[model samples]
Target: MSRPVDRESPDRLYTITSGRSRGGDEVFDAVTLVVAECDPTPGMQSEHSRILRMCQRPMAVVEVSARLGLPVNVVRILLTDLLDAGRITARHPTAVNSAVSPFASPDVLEKVLVALQKL
Candidate 1:
C-alpha cells in the first residue's frame, strides 16, 4: 500500500524555518549525501523528524528536497542546523559539483566561450 501523505498547514514551513533564507555557513551541495546522527525525538519539528528518518540509510540533498517538496536552500538550512548540532553528517558525493557541465574544464570552457563570442 502507498504511504499516506503528511499534510502541513500552509504556514508550517515559515514556522519551521523561522523566516531565514540561508541554512548556514556549511554549504551542502544538491548531491551531498546525508545520514542522521541519531534518532529524532517526537518533540522535534515534523520536518526535522522526517529528514532524520529519511536520512537513516543515506539520501542525497536533492532527493530530500524533492521528497519533502521544499526548496533546496530551505532544506539546506534545516540540514545545516542538524549538522552543526551533530545530528547529521553531510558528505559531498564527489569532489566536483555534479551540476557543472562536462565542458566546464577551463580549456574547453574557454574554447566554447570564444566560439560563442565569434558567433
Candidate 2:
C-alpha cells in the first residue's frame, strides 16, 4: 500500500510563500539541483530550515517537493526566498550536444537512470 500524502493546508502554503504564486527572477525546473550554501540561522522559518538540512547534498527540485509533501510551485516560491537570502544555490541542467556523449562513463549513465526511475 502507498503511504498517505501529508500536505499542509492551502493557508499554510500561502503563508510559507508569502502570498506569492510563483518564484521570483530565478527560474527552476523539476530537474534543477539545489544545495544549501550554509546552515539555516536561528529564528528562520521552519520550512527554510528543513530545506537547508535536506539540501546539504544536491537534490532536484522535484525530489524536494516529493520529500517535503509540498506542491512544486510552492516549493519554487520558497526556493526563491532562500536564493534571495543566499542560503541556497540552484544549478540548472545543461544541454548536451547531440554529437557528444552525455555521460562520462557507463556507470555514471546507469546511476542517473536509477535515480530517474526512483522518481
Candidate 3:
C-alpha cells in the first residue's frame, strides 16, 4: 500500500518541472523528491524568507550577499543554516549559469569598466 501523505508533517515532497531552450529545441525535465522540513524561529523568519525568495532563482553566495546588502561571511553563515534546514540549496557557478550579469549591455559594461578603472 502507498503511504499516505501527512498534512501535519513538515517533510513533504515536491516535483520541479522545467523546460530549457537549447538551440531552438525545447527540452522538458522533472525532478521529484522529498524535501526536509523548513521551520525557522520567529526571529529568523524574515531572513529565511529572503533566502527562500532568492532560491527560486539560482544564486551564488556573492549575489545573495550583494542583493541583501549583507557581508559575504554573514551570508555564508545564513546559507549554511538554510542548507541544514533544507530551505535552500547551493550550486556551482559553472554547473549552472545563474549568475546575474552585472553588465548586460555594452553601455553598462563600459560604465562598469570605467568605474573599476577609477577604483
Candidate 4:
C-alpha cells in the first residue's frame, strides 16, 4: 500500500498570492532583473519582506523563485505588489549576441567559485 498524502502541509501558491495569478499591468520574464529600492511599508506581508531582502543584490526572477522556494508565477505576483508599491524595480537583462558563448573564462570561474564559497 502507498503512504498517505499530507494535504495541508504545503503553503499553496494561490494562498500566497491572495488567490491571484496575474500580478498587474507590467510583465515579468524568468530573466527579468529586480532590485530592492525601499524599506518595507505598512500592510506588507512577511513574504514581501523576504523578497526585498533577496532582491537587494540584483537577482533575476527565476533566481529569486529558487532562493525563496516559491513558484515563478507566485514570485511574479509578489514582485508585482512590490513594483506597484515602489519598493522594488524590475528590468530586463541586457541582450547578448547569439554567436558569443555566455560562459566565463576558467580564471573568472575560479574567482566566482571562491566568492560563492565565502558566501
Provide the TM-score for each candidate, comma-separated.
0.67, 0.75, 0.42, 0.67
Q: Top model by TM-score, which number?
A: 2
Better of 1 and 3 by TM-score: 1
Comparing 2 with 3 on lDDT, the higher-scoring candidate is 2
Candidate 3, residues 15-88, lDDT tens digits: the string is: 10012112111111111111224444466646556766655656556666677665444455556556666675
Model 2 lDDT tens row, 39-99: 9899999888999999999999999999888999998888988988899999987877645
Candidate 1 C-alpha error for residue 75, in Å = 0.5
In order, candidate lDDTs are: 0.83, 0.87, 0.48, 0.80
lDDT of 1 by residue, 1-119 (tens): 99654444436566778877676546798888999989999788888899999999889999999999887887888998898889998887657654586766788889998999999
Clashing pairs in 2: none
Model 4, residue 100: displacement in angstroms?
12
Indicate the worst ten consecutive residues by lDDT in candidate 3: 15-24
Candidate 3 vs. true structure, TM-score: 0.42
Report the Cα lDDT for candidate 3. 0.48
Among these predictions, the greatest lDDT belongs to 2
- In model 2, the Cα lDDT at residue 105 comes to 68
Residues 1-119 of candidate 4 have per-residue lDDT tens digits of: 99674332245666778888677436789989999998776777978998898788789999988888777878888899889888999899887664464454666779889999999
Q: lDDT, candidate 4, residue 34?
A: 90
Q: Quote the lDDT for 39 in model 4.
A: 70
